[model samples]
Target: MDVTQSTAGDVIEVRPMTIHIGAELFGVDLAGSLTDEQVAAIRRALLRWKVVFFRDQALDHEAHVRLARHFGAPTPAHIVFGTNESHPEVYSIAKHRTAQNGRTSATRCWSGWHTDITAAINPPWASILRGVTVPPYGGDTQWTNLALAFARLSTPMQRFVEGLRAVHRFDAPAGDGDYARRVGARDLAAEHPLVTMHPETGEKVLYVSPGFVKEIVGLEPSESRALLENLWEHAVSTEFTVRFRWAPGSVAFWDNRATAHLAPVDIFATDFERQFYRVTLNGEVPVGVDGRPSTLLSGEPIEAQPA
Candidate 1:
């Protein structure tokens, strides 16, 4: 699948990475400033593909921030993890060593499937990540199209979930290992619809994930757990996903509202260093098919501002 033309007349070559999720973009240099036509074309591709990849652009922190601004205002690094020293909007994901035994840790704390910042009332609309020090062999990231995930479910299941809502909390569950420790005491939570309508494309998306959703709002505890587990399993089926291997200078810009991504744990076991910089774009509050909006349980709203 490919999109070769845009209303702005800039020809962007989009090569589909998978039938369900991702596309690789060509004919645009992200390191330099982009024209309005190119930016429009890229945004169109992102809505169609859910996630888009670019290779060999070699964007530095400044260039990365500038590229993200073409789509939407970039949010601050993160309320918990903080920002890079020079760039306030850039969040560094550099993990070179583990504190225990001074050896490379065998497990990565972020190796779960999640949409970025779902604990917030309005999660990020998009996330742009640039590979700065990727390992040669491992650390591929996988994304599944949430819209596709919803579309594939049975009609009965779809009807049952479209009107429901779930709680998303930032605290990692017990025995989740390094992830739990790293997330210490952030205390963020929110309630979002089980099926969210895309603010731009009007597509319905499966909005639950194992990483953040704690319970279905109106169900009994046991029933909620069973139902959530079933939905989680269906959401990540391989048929709906695309895996992108990383290389130095490679970039992935994804629609957080329409997909969930997983960072593999294999890279931590290897001796190679893995680092990346991420910038999230501001998003509007999610609304259900019934027209109810997501409610914040705790935490302030994200302030959208250009980098």
Candidate 2:
């Protein structure tokens, strides 16, 4: 399908990167000022593509924050990580600094498939990441369209999951070892419906991820494990994904409500450093298609902290 749109007489060309998930936008420089019409068109492209990419336009911290503010309010740096000293809104996802005492932190690689901060009562609406330093090879990230993943399920399976809710926690599940210790050690946990309705587009999205979702609520231990494993597998099927290779100055902006992403671990194997600055837009509490809103099992609501 043709997804490109033009606004304010400045044609915005949106080139689809894959059948289901991503698009590369041309004719707009993120480092410069954007017209209101251009911003609207970019929002439209985001709804259509799930994630949008930009290449070659170098952006500093200020430029990055400006770019994000054009679309939505930027939240404070991530709840867990430290933010840039000057730009408090931007989270630094650098490989070297994430480690402790010379040993890599469990969160360092972050190679698993997952959504951003689902353990919070309100996850971020979107995430804008700009590559500050990219490796020469093997640090590509991937995103999957959760709406598409939901649509591909059989009628009965869809119905089954629609009524289900799952618990997402920061603690690691059994057998995760150091990785779990790193991620799950945080004091965060929440319950959200398995099928969430996009607040803006009203589309049904498969919301479970192996990274945060620990178990299906109200199910037997064995049943929950088996079912979650199956859902996780289906949600990340290759047919529903798009992969993007990063380079210095490259940017990826995605709707966190409708997608899940995988961070690359291959970059850690080499001496090359991979660094990015991320800014997230505060999101509302998710509502399921069944009309029930997500419930907080442990943590407090995610409040908007002015950038």
Number of clashing residue pairs in every model?
A: 0, 2
TM-scores for the candidates? 0.90, 0.90
Error of 2 at 25 (Å): 0.2
The numbered model that scores best in lDDT is 1
Tell me model 1's lDDT, rounded to 2 decimals. Answer: 0.83
Residue 256, candidate 2: Cα error in Å is: 0.4
Off by over 4 Å in 2: 1-10, 97-111, 172-186
Name the top TM-score candidate: 1
Q: For every candidate structure, what is the RMSD over all alpha carbons to the true structure, in angstroms? A: 3.9, 3.7
What does candidate 2 score in Cα RMSD to the true structure? 3.7
